[model samples]
Every structure is written in structure tokens, then in C-alpha cells.
Target: MSTANTSNNTDSAIGAPVSATLPTLSRQDRDDSRPQQYPSPSSPHATSATSPPIPTPSPRNGRAGYQLSLPIPRLQRSEWVNLEGLVECALSSLGKDECTGISELGRGSHNSLYEIRFSDGTSCAASISNSPRQFFSADAKRSEIATMQYIHSSKLYKIPIPKIYSWDLTFDNKVGAPYILRECVKGKNLSEDGRFYRLNARDKQKVVKELAHVQAELSKPSEFTQLGYIYRQEGENGQFYVGKMATVPSGSDEEDKMRESFMGPYDSLTELWEARIERETLCAIGNWSQLPSDASLPSMLPPAKANPQQFGELQQLLSGLTNLFTPPEQLSKLCIHHSDLAIRNVLFDEKTLKITGVIDWEFASVMPLVITGRFPNDLGWEGNEFARSLGKFGNVSDGGVWNHHYYDWTSLSGVQPPPRADMPSPPASPTHSPASIDYLTTPNATANGYLFEHQASVLEDFDNSEGRAPSPPSPPLPPPPTSETSQQDLTSRATNLVELYYYRKFYASKLAARNFNLTRLFIDAVAYIKFNEIVLGGPEKWFASADWIKEVYWRMQEEDESAREDLMEGKGVVKVPEVFLAVRRREVDLGKWENKVMSMR
Candidate 1:
């Protein structure tokens, strides 16, 4: 999913929100691509949940052609062929009033979305997925449903997530795919409705705060189906088990022992997601290129012998062997996920500006644990990426070790693209260069058919406080000293946010690292660096302030050979090379400054 970005820094976290001095959005652009039909299927919210008929909003600006309905016949597939039947069953389970209409919304990389409206006009969302195969296995699908169910069943899970009105599967399909249905969630999808941009800073901050809460709650994994928060403790056995009094329900002693060995603590929702990704990534690596991924990293990890005979047997039935590996010890492993936890997937009220709901579930999964920072530019506007190499290659333990590949925003895209008409404003700006981003395509793997894994500190730090809240609405900010938000009570919230950044940076960096090209880092790191570039330049630069850039620029400029020599020796610094070129382009868009700098060359 490549996105075309705009110079809209409205949500660029380094500073306060302002009337965005944005490049014209594609909404106004003449798209020469194929005639796009934002086909909204007829899966409206179940009639049981409807509040009132929100007659399709009059076309914006009197544009009469945006139809609220697409004639594509619903439930055409033979497997999920009888949605009406499933709907009936769901209606029965949800107390016939739980549904109003099942209108189709759209689809994603893995599932089909349906809107379920109840009779009250209030609605929730529903999804009907094909046989959960490939990236989404049935168990994982069930797990997601279970995760949702966990939310619906808990008290702390008061994040406005859509409730599962009912879930049905025409189970006869290992033959095809399974069917899932949920209720419709109301409010403007900031991704879809442009009105969200009009929100005042107070509302935006409130939205972000609530988002942090939901994320934290979602990350807490409890034994019973609880969503938001889950407190846990070890049971009689030495194994880590989530028990009563404070935690959600746990499995039987046997199940607990078996799962506890690998899953780690189910104390938080993110911990579970993190644990799951580790196991999934662990099991995900299986001869994709068939060149034998594990063959090279033999000395890197523990030896696990897979039966060659067993491998030979499965090779016949499989296409791309993406193994769904089970965890050896339930408590030790975590999942690979978008550590970046922003309100990119949320919607807000047109009047109140309060968040309606959060959406994007694509990067949500059980993945490897070694991933540190995904998106390098997610940290406010300053392009900073961090990672935990997990000592896979060394004898070290834990994942906080740093492999310093310094330099800011030189590798990737500079200004971030504007928020898509279809997605919420992404939390971070990719301040890399224009050439390309150095993101990862494949999971890191090893010689014994193992994939490289790292711990995501995301879920563990999902809590939030005053600092994490959006800055108060004010006139554009005057330069201020750096305020430490390191302890913003962001327990799992920060961790999730970290994972998102980690994913972005990892893929972008790996993109650069792949061909052994350090420029790749520059390519992806550029957007981030550019944000910093603007930060360096201070207010003189529209994309950023001009003061910061001038400072960095002067720091790097060689005043004399002695000064350069001193910088080279790490003594008196002539300049900071970490300031990359891609970032300089942000506020210097006119090139007037660039040409003048070239004259100095």
C-alpha cells in the first residue's frame, strides 16, 4: 500500500496543531488513474441496531453523483452464499433486535466489511471474511473474534469498539472461507469524513487520550474474555497463569501450563498481541524462496530439528509454506505488530469531536519479538528510529542494545502525504527522501527455518497521562524547551505506538539494508529527517521552523580546515553529518535557499 503524501503537518507531533499550511490535497487533484468506484456494499448496520435513518448525506458541495448504494448482489459466493441464513442465526443470538440492515462497506487486505445497524439508529460494524487463509488463518480469525468478544465481555474495555452482534460460519468450508458479522459503529471515519480536520485542539487531544485508553485496554490479555484491562498473577504451579480476583478467566491447569510456557503474561492486551506475533513469526518462516532461510544463521540461534520427512510430506500440498507455528512455551513469546499506536484508525463526532471508533486492523497480528521500531519517523517530527536487535547474532540477552546508524531524515521521503480520503491522519510523518523508503518485505529468519524475532515494548507501555495528551489549542507555538514525555503514564499505549514506528522504520531501513545500500536508510529516513530539517530551520520554513535547520546547517558547515579536523577527531564539532539532505527540502521547497547553499559549495 503506497501512499502519496502532502506537506500537511497539522498533526506533526513535534509542535502544536495549527491551520495546516498544506499542499493541495488529491481530493482536488484530477486522478488520471482508473475510474475509481468507492463501491460501498449493501451490508448496512443490522436493522436491530439502527437509531434512525441517516439518509445518505446530501452529496458534499452538491456533487450529486456519489451513490449510497452499489447494485452488486450481496452474498453471491456459494460458500458464504447464504448470508441471509447466517444473518437469521445472528439475529437469533443477538436478540432479534440486534440487527437492522447488513450493508456492505468495503474490503481490506484480508476481510470484507459490513455495517450492522440496529433498530435504534445506533450501529456497529460487521465483517464477513473468506476462509481465513494465507496471512489470516481461521484460528487467527477466531482469535480476532475472541479478542473482540474479550472487549465486549469486560468492564475496563470501555473503548467504543464495535460489539459482535453475532458471528456465524458455514463451517463446511475448510473448502472455502468462513463468514463473520458484527454491528455498525457510528461517527465520521476521519479517514473518510473530512470534517474531522475541523476539530479544535481540545477535541483532538481528547480523542487521542481515549484512543490511548482503548489501545491499552486492547493490549491487556486476560484469562476470561476481557478487553481493556487485565490484571494477572501466577497460580499454584511455577508457570505464569492469569487467575481470578484481579484477572480474567484462565484455562484449566493443564491448558494453562501448556500455554504459559510461551505466551508470557496476559496482564495486558498488547502483551498478548505481542506474544502472539512472536509465535506467528516464529512459525511464519518456511522456505518462501525455498533457498533455505535458516541455512545461513545456524550459529545465530538454538537448533530446532524439523523432520525432513515431515517437510517433504507438506511440500506436496502447500503453495507458499507460511507455517503457523505454535509456541513452545506460551508465556515466553510475543507477536510482531504495528508498535505505532496513534489515532490513525479512529473517527470523531461531527459536533462533539469525540472519537467514535478506531479502525485499521491490518498490521494487528502475532509476530516476531525482535522488531524495535517499525516506522523511523513516528517520533513527533524529529526523525528518530530505534530498534532492539535482540542479540540474535551475539551472546547477549534482552533487546535494548543499540546498533547506531546515525543521521537524521536523509534516507526517506520528506513531507508526509496528507491523510487519505479513506484513512485517518497517520500519527507520524515519514520524513525520508523522495527516492524510496527502506522498509522490510520479509521477516528476519534463520538457518533452522527460524525467523529473527524481537520484543515490542509497545503493549507493555499503553498507559497515558497529561503529556501524551494533545497540546492545548493556542496560537502557533513560540519556541519552547524540550518537555520530557518519557513518563506520560503510557504503559501499553506507548508500546503500541513504538511498534507502529518500529514497523515503519524496520521495513524502510531493511529496504535500504537489502542491497547493502546505506542510501536506502537515507531513502526511508529522509521523511523523518526532513521533519527535523524543518524543526532545525525554525518558523522561517513553512514546513518547519527555520531556527533549528540553520543551527544544524551551521554546525555541519566547515568554517575552517582546523574546525573540520577537530570535528573529524570528535573534539570541536564543525557540523553534524547526521543531518541528512532529504530533510532539508521540507521548508526549503522553493529551492532559493538550496541554490544559495550550492554557491557556498
Candidate 2:
């Protein structure tokens, strides 16, 4: 690869035009010019606005001039409920309770969490959903409550889950949003000591067994006609009926828009699989501009309309992989699945190696057993390595059944994992430091914590949502591909890994059609390549009609290399990294009907 020259389009951070040769400031000089680091957890600045502003390199608009500042796109500000109002709402749920203490737990794209304590020493957590989406609707919230209540009632697994004390799904109350108050699970997250790496072999083995049992219980066949989200609906006579998601998901509206009509509690696995693909495609196209931006991404050049032929090729690639996962004839068993089963959602008594609570069931649904049998993602995840592993063609293997240690839990007879005698250490002591236990448990991906929740949180939060104003759909969907076409896509010599190639091709065309900013496109492309380098073996794709893509890829790689060099010398600018998890489709009502319910109230 030839060295990249930035003389034509790129300018320095200070707005000075750059020469063909790159700047060569001393490491110390670069370090001095770099942005200030986040303050220590104990420092007042750590948790307050006193800290330095997040660096926004060249946050310029339009497609004309380009500068080489960090490419962190602006965060879209969404409507959030007042913390004081939220506190009052939680207190009201408890009926004449006196609030002794309260603190903001955390906030995600759609929900804000708060922990409340009453004078009677009773504590509970309030999860208030704001700006609900198709994936995180009132129905999804209701499903979560029903699932947790069911689990607690069934006593199926030895593990425990938080008990719901109160819930309001209609937002008919003063809170004006769906809120749930539940028992505050009192244990450290399983990842408190650095994920699985920090756990002893005994602890690891113990956790695996316990989790397997929980899996078995959830997978047990129950009274259900088809596969979909599980929710509780109260009838006119005051009887609550448990069944499929209150609203099945249809791939036709903006993810944030709630609708009454959806696909189904499919009778066949193939039908469900097709619905899943349709939902994803619709979401990507419909919510392109609503996604979030990443701080570390490099901006893209002005995107031009992609050629129909190129777009068609990309479509063929996507269809290929979609079919690979969605078998046509095989009827897979369906069962309840915790779609987002990661370490952060699992609370543990580390000393005793016992699971305290399993939280966050918004994405829970009844789906094919293969979907649930795959090992928990946290099993082998750790930073960039996890990304690299995804790209490794050799790693392309079928999912396996959960490893059973104690009993033949595969039968789903509500059996528990073997009991152990180990006693758990006391919870970490309270501290005023910003990194205290409270802040640590917030599900987020930052330098300080595990990135699983961070990944799960950012699915619809795409990086270029606003940086590039979306254009009209360029090329319409082509005829679906046949089995032979899919086979060709997988066997392509350019990349042995079929999955990575198809995703890259599909997104490239999709973004181009939407007129994604050129610089941002380059940044996203390179990051994808770097993270999945092992899978692709190397970045080589003949199907990419946008020639500028290769150039930007090389340039961004060069810039990243330079930044790393400066980082080693303690003087280079560092971009805040971002993670993307697959979008989980479950039943959620964005509020069309809820609004009607509120109106009646």
C-alpha cells in the first residue's frame, strides 16, 4: 500500500492546510496538544461538568472543506423525564412511603434508571422508558414484567430475578411514561472482577452450570401456540391471560413508531426467520437517520447515487447470508429465549459463585432453540479480540447446546444446577468516589466497564445518523436470490467468511444510496475491516463499485496508525470507540395505542 497524502482534501486540526508530507511533531509536543484525560473517579470533575468537554474534531457541516479533527458526530438529544418527577413517581408507587434517599442510576438511549430508598429501609429500582421504539415498547416492557413474575412464581431455576412491585405501561399517570418499580437486586455484577478472566476455574465452572439450568427452565415447552414475545393481558372480567407478545412486530414502520399490526407468533420456524429478516431490513431503511453516531469514526466524502448493478450485487449478497441462517424446511423447536443474555445483565455473588439476579428482559422472546443454545457472548469477549474473532473464517462454526454439568437439564424439567458451599463476600463498601458500586453497575460501555450493554444499547444508534443527510432510495430492492446465488456468495474467493462480506456489501450500498457523508463512511468501513480483519483475511472486495472506498480505507488506516504511535508516546488524540450489537426484535408498542389509552384516562 502506498503512503497516504492529505495535501488535497485534509487539513490539520488547527485549520492549517497540510503539505504532502504529514506533520512530525515530537511525541511530547503531541501529548501536550492532546485533549485532557478524564479526571480520577474521586475528583469532583469526574462526575461533573467541570471536566473537559468531549473533543469534537471538525464537527463541520456540508461536503466542501474537510479537516482532520476527531470525527465524533454529535449526540442527538432526546426527550428525557425530570429526575425529581421520576423520584416522586417511584415513591407514589409504594403508597405513602417516605423517601429517605435517591440517586440516578443510569440512562440509555430509551430508558433512564433510578434507585430509591424509603425511610422503612425498603429499596427498589425504577426503570422509566422514554422515547420507546419498536424494539423497546410498552408491550416489550409488559413482557419483561410478565416474564420476571412468571420466573419468580414458577421457581423453575435455582437463580433469582428481581420481583416487580409496580408497573404502569400506559403512561396514563403523572409520570407520562412507562415505569416499573422492582426489588433492587443486591449483588455485584458477574463482571465486577474483569469478566471471566478474573474468575477462578471453580467459579467459572459453577457459573456455567447455574446459567445452563436457567436456560433449561426457560426452554421448557409450555402452553404456547407459536413463537413470539410473551406478555400478560387483562381481560374484561379481570383475568390476566399469558400469551404471545401483545403486538407482533411488522417490518413496516419507523422503529420509534408504535403500531397495532405486526407479523405473528409464527407456527413455523421459517416464517419467524423470514419475519426477522424483514424486520431488520425495514428498520435499517426506516430508521437510518435516527441512529446514534460514534465518536471515533472518520467522516466520509459526499456520497453519490450507487449504480443499480452494484446495489443489486449487494442485495444478492445479503439474501445469501439471510437464507443461510434461515433454513427453508427444518422445523426447529421454539422456546422462551433471553435475547440479551450477557454478563452485565447477570448479577452474581462473586465469592460464592451464585447468580443473584438476571435482569433486562425487554428483548426476551420465544424463538428457535438454536438461537438460545449458542453460548453466552460474554464467554470469550474481551475488547478488540472479540471483534477480530468475528472476522475469522475458520471460526465459522454452528452453535452448540449449553454445557450441562449437574443434571440432564436439556429436558427442561425445571431442574437447578448443582448447589455449592462457597459463601459470597460482602458487597463492595460504599464510596463517594465516582467509580463507586452504584455507578459501576450502570449498563454502559466506557473505558471503565464491560462493553456488552454498550453494544446492546447502540443497535439502532448508527454512527452516521446525522452526519450525512439521507438521500432518496437509489436502487429499489431486486428479485430475491436463489440457492445457487447464495452458494456463490458464500464460496466467493475474495472472502472465505460469508457473513462478513455480505454485511459489508449490504451496508456499503445502503449508506451510499442514503448519501452518507464520504468521510464518515470511510471511518466506519475501516473500523469494520480492522475489527473483522481475521474473518476477511484481508480487505479485498471486487463488488465495491465506489472506488473511493478503498482510498478512504487506506487513509483512515494510516491515520489510525499515526494516532496509535502518538498514543504510545502519550501525545496522540484518541477517539472514543463504539460498539454495535444485532437488533433484537420483540413485541413493543411504540405508544400509538398507549396514547389512546392515556387519552381516555
Taken over the whole model, the C-alpha lDDT of each candidate is 0.30, 0.37
Q: Which lDDT tens digits does candidate 2 get at residues 1-601?
A: 0000111110000111111111111122111111111111222221111111222222223211122111111211135343334445554455423444443444444554545544344556666764433333456566677776666666444447766777666545545566777666545544422444456655656666555555655655545557666765552123223444443233335432432323465664445434443543453344333535322111121112222333334334433322223311111345567755555566566467677677767646776543443334344232122122222211211110101100111121211221122532211111111111010011121112211222222323421222110110111112222223343432331132222233323333433343322213323223222211111111111122122222222333456555545533434322312321222222365867875896599
Which one is best on lDDT? Answer: 2
lDDT of 1 by residue, 164-273 (tens): 44443334422134555454444543322222234554654445445444433443333333212122122211222122111111223443343344334344333433
Cα-based lDDT at residue 446, candidate 1 = 11
Q: Which ten residues in a row have the lowest lDDT in candidate 1?
A: 1-10
lDDT of 1 at 522: 32
lDDT for position 592 in model 1: 74
lDDT of 1: 0.30
Assess every candidate by TM-score. Answer: 0.37, 0.46
How far in Å is the alpha carbon of 183 misplaced in model 2?
0.9
